[model samples]
Target: MPDGQEVHYGDYVQDDRVHKAVYADQAVYESELDNIFHKKWIYIGHESQVPNPGDYWTTWVGKERMIMSRGSDGAVHVLYNRCPHRGSLICNNEHGNAGKAFRCPYHAWQFYMDGSVRQVPMKQGYDGVIDYKDPQFSMVRAERQGNYRGFIFASLSTEGEDLETYLGQGARAAFDDICNRSPQGEAEIVANCFRIIQHSNWKIFLENQLDAVHPSITHHSTGDAAAAMQKKYKDKTGDDAPMGYQFLADFTLPFEKWDSLQTVGFPNGHTQLTGYMGLRPRDPVTLAHEAALTDAYGAERMDEILSTNVHHVIVYPCLSVQPPLQQLRAVRPLGPNKTLTEIWHFRLKGAPDGIYERALAYYYHVNSPSTMVNADDLNNFRAIQEGLAMVGGGDWVSLHRNAGQDTVDNGVTHSVTGMSEMPMRNMFAAWKQFMTEGN
Candidate 1:
């Protein structure tokens, strides 16, 4: 487990498997909410989403309603989205600029963009009863907030590791890669996101993110169909097929090649699988994109940036981030069995038109609701959850593949084979720490 000075909760979890109750027990789920979601810093939204003062977006840390917004003075603040006066929600909309401040719709109690109390209509009524200037009467801000590059995260608990420490070595390069590709070194949230509610445990989705062994099986049909279409398109046009088509087909990559890929298990339950998608086609748009990247970061740096082969980085417990495609899926656990995942994609700030188009295509085709790829995964997750809930199910879930073979260096674990269960083990390792720590 992690060698932090603080007591480790992960000692209870064994290396190769975890107790089945971790998934099906309500008490464990509640504990996870308190320890993992409440204690750890969670990604809310980018500062770019609310670039202007008064702009806010509402999200969650467990069941707690939280808002990330830009204050009047331009600093970003993450606050609980509840009105202190009567517990009315301060911000009802998913995202929008509040003009200057937030006004609760139910009671009309207002708060500044920074969550400070602005007005109380019945202040005279409370003049003799209570002190309005007290912190309890003001809208509550998140206990701790931090940002990495442009990505912002908030922690409900005042204790525990800071954001940089929490991200450890597993922080997504997609942020640095995307933002640095721009002349200004920044990326902005483009409007809203595509939200999805999965009828399964949130862990299922997180575990699948770095499971290099699943795509070729779960998405084989979509991949085979895309491969067929890709070949047909090239045969007729006598030129390279569109990258998106090949991107879909690559889902059916041969087992041997899939096994050869690598999954890196970083500290704090974060894990990443490397293998770049073959999305660069020899088309006018792609050529233009290459030129733009070369112009912005120079050819050597551009090659280094584009050559980054990260497929997915599972920021354990809350997010599955695909930085290469500017994609993030924020996990919200609804119950022991139900979870909601918000699928969001971003445009690289100051990048070329074709670059954004490539990301958008992947978003729509692979991650979007209409995609067969997503539907297949959702169905599998639901089935797995149902199976796990059964009385006849096994007591422990296995993560035994290449379990003892993982090599550790500087607290990071690298699976010897792509099919290794190192990702799952690494996550459970953190889970144990979170669940058992300080209890």
Candidate 2:
């Protein structure tokens, strides 16, 4: 195809494989910003990030800058960051308290936390020329917004399924599992998050989250070193290594072990991987945490909550959640070849301090930008992106691993093998629907 030619999106997607242009083409990337990110329910910041009235945080939805603010009435609002008067950004900092109103630095135009126009300077200058009371003069809010638990999401389209329905069971379980572990049945966001810009397409990051086959191969060195430290610690001090060491050592699990696990695909591209990590060891920290939950709810209910087996959930096209680790990475596409990911971890309210420390250790050990596990994955992502952009190498990327072997029941798909590419296929299916049908 020639440059600037009108491309049919359906031609690039198939049942088993997808064309490389879907990951490399500039046109396809632009279409995605409109069809998927703008129309779908994209995750905004958590409600706890802006707990107090007039507090605000700035984030992105597709290419637009957005603000998540806490209003005086104790409701969360998602609004455009732009000032209506001169098109200036209302909040210049990433996050801060705006007191009672946001005063634009450009012309001192003020607006309330909920984006209602509050005061205008020199009102007599345009007495009958323009009505300042019109909505156009105030900052614009997202077309629709919804909250699940404490997490928030906003959609630019007026029509679509509600947030919970869009999330389906698989994605909803991610949030529920995270909150249920706390005695208070809630999770709060830790202030600030690690941000990384990867030289790869946004979809590539989502695909890698549930790839299942790459961890043992890619992070082999890191896992081996951690395992060695575990043995050395036991031999010298006669004590078991910290849980942080086990976090990395788990990456050394053989391919057969990974294949024994299961992956499930739900509607609208949501997918989940069953937990493989042994998180329920009889350590003192674990016992104390379990006791707190058991006190809040009975023993049987506490066991049910702790026994929920889930490792990771992909909230298609936007979020990669690890409910077990209390970590979430939000995807933001900068271009066809560049993507930004925000790494956030939550603290389970009313849980033992040791439990929170375990989550923090995983945050720095496995998910942090400096960790070897992420470094290995980042190298592969950039390499894959570079390979796809080249001509004459190949036209399609194979997703044939256990493709036709998946079983479907009540609109959910279960892979025959853990290494199956069903999750990738499922995401592209949703992508094709959004691109071709404009849903």
Best by lDDT: 2
Per-residue lDDT of 50-103 in model 2, one digit per residue for the tens?
999999999889999999999999999999999999899999998999999999
What's the TM-score of every candidate structure? 0.93, 0.97
Q: Write the per-residue lDDT of candidate 1 for residues 100-219, one digit (tens) a residue.
A: 779989877778888887887878888889977778988899999999998999999989888888887686554665676554567777665788888777888899888878989999
Using TM-score as the measure, the top candidate is: 2
lDDT of 2 at 239: 89
Q: Cα miss at 5, model 2 (Å)? A: 6.0
